[model samples]
Target: MPMKPAPDAPLCFHTLIHRLEKLKLNYLEIPAAVVQQLGGTFNIRLQCSVNGAEAFACGLVALGEGRGYITLSSKRMKPQGLQLGQQVAVRLWADTSEFGMEVPEELAELLRQDEEGDRRFRLLPPGKQRYIIYHVSGVKSSQKRLDRALLLINNLKQLPPGKEDFRAMLGLPPREAL
Candidate 1:
């Protein structure tokens, strides 16, 4: 069964939306006081809910001063009828899952089919592994996700430290202009 957001998951709050300048992506600011309350472990995973929707594994961004934020993908927002600048309740818990998020069946099967890919994938940091899993999960089509997973795995043999190279090799969009 997919993990559900726990009422006991360390923290819960109502946050206002904020847009990343230039990128135009919308996100929810996780307050610094809350971050400090969570012991400043910004790299940690959380099972998060925006409003009352089903929860998904979320990672907190830890960049500059205003960096404690969660990306609010349209996929995860539409069903709940969310909008920019709206205050919504968010529940967050420490994620204890093996992959940080639930493993997409497509990616899992592809990994199982290629031992070398599996080895290389396991060698990546847990966060990177989850990023791959989450990236594959972003698409609406199972076929597309499977296709991306194949390209990602095959390229993992010599892929570099940046996501853009992987995105280019996978024929996907660049995440940032940088």
Candidate 2:
């Protein structure tokens, strides 16, 4: 059986009508009152569904003065025929998945088979772990996913604990060099 949401979980959004705003970027404003009702903070991860589209993992980004917004990337908007200034139905739910986002099968299986890799991955901050997971899971090809998972785990293990550098893990030059 699946576990139920905790009593205090900010599991729903009250707003159903919101205009997609574009000021150098596209997003929908989350009312301050709604934010207050959903735990009064902007730090929680969420699963958002727009206009009944499939829910996608996201977070409420602070936009000052107690207001927040979830950005809609063009990649996300285009496929759904989302247009600027259009009204949308946005629903939000508390993200309860481990690691805050869905872990891809390739990465999950690799971590399960490699003890040291899993240990190193767990030692990183949650945000860093999400970054690595996103990188590995963003592609469309299974071979590419496995390749990225292998690359990340191998590079992660090469670094000492508590001293991992994302740039180095991706084989990029030190940030200071750029």
Candidate 3:
């Protein structure tokens, strides 16, 4: 069953952590009317103003029906000792998956360009693909991410399934090759 947001809407902005602490609400359902009320595909930054100071929250968006919900993990903000009617500012914008560590679209495109690339990659065990994706996305800098992604694609073209040259892909010398 789909969960529904309260009509009162908690002021459409803020809800106290203590009030929400024991609430094991997994998913917040936004009605279609609410989506129409707000423009489509918006970004929101959750902010907590506590003790006359404000702090930004690390949050994720969960899309459902026509509306989206900004979910704050407990780690980001503890929902304890929070006062009722506390202000939670939500700043909205378009969503961009590139803001965080994720598989590069360019890498996917590179794989798609080759006739057999997708097949070869798909044939590999899931673990291998996940390892490559993690390694490629783990780099902090954009240049490093791109470089690693290109190297991975090239290595995929050369190596057989189940056999990856991690050192070669990273431009590091292999023990034997060295």
**Using TM-score as the measure, which candidate wins?**
2
Give RMSD to native, each candidate: 5.7, 4.5, 10.9
Q: Choose 1 or 3, whichever is better by lDDT.
A: 1
**Backbone clashes under 3 angstroms, per model:** 0, 0, 3
lDDT of 2 by residue, 36-152 (tens): 666668767878888788888887878778888887788888898977777777777778888889999999999999999999999999889999999998999989999999998
lDDT of each: 0.77, 0.80, 0.49
Candidate 3 TM-score, true structure as reference: 0.38
Residue clash pairs of candidate 3: 17-79, 43-92, 43-93
lDDT of 1 by residue, 25-141 (tens): 788899876676666756767778778778888788875663488888876777878888899998788778888889889999988888988988887878678778988898999
- Among these predictions, the greatest lDDT belongs to 2
Q: Kindly indicate the candidate among 1 and 3 with the higher TM-score.
A: 1
For model 3, what is the C-alpha lDDT against the true structure? 0.49
Instruction: Kindly report which residue stretches of model 2 are placed more than 4 angstroms away from their true locations once superposed.
Output: 1-24
* Better candidate number, 1 or 2, judged by TM-score: 2
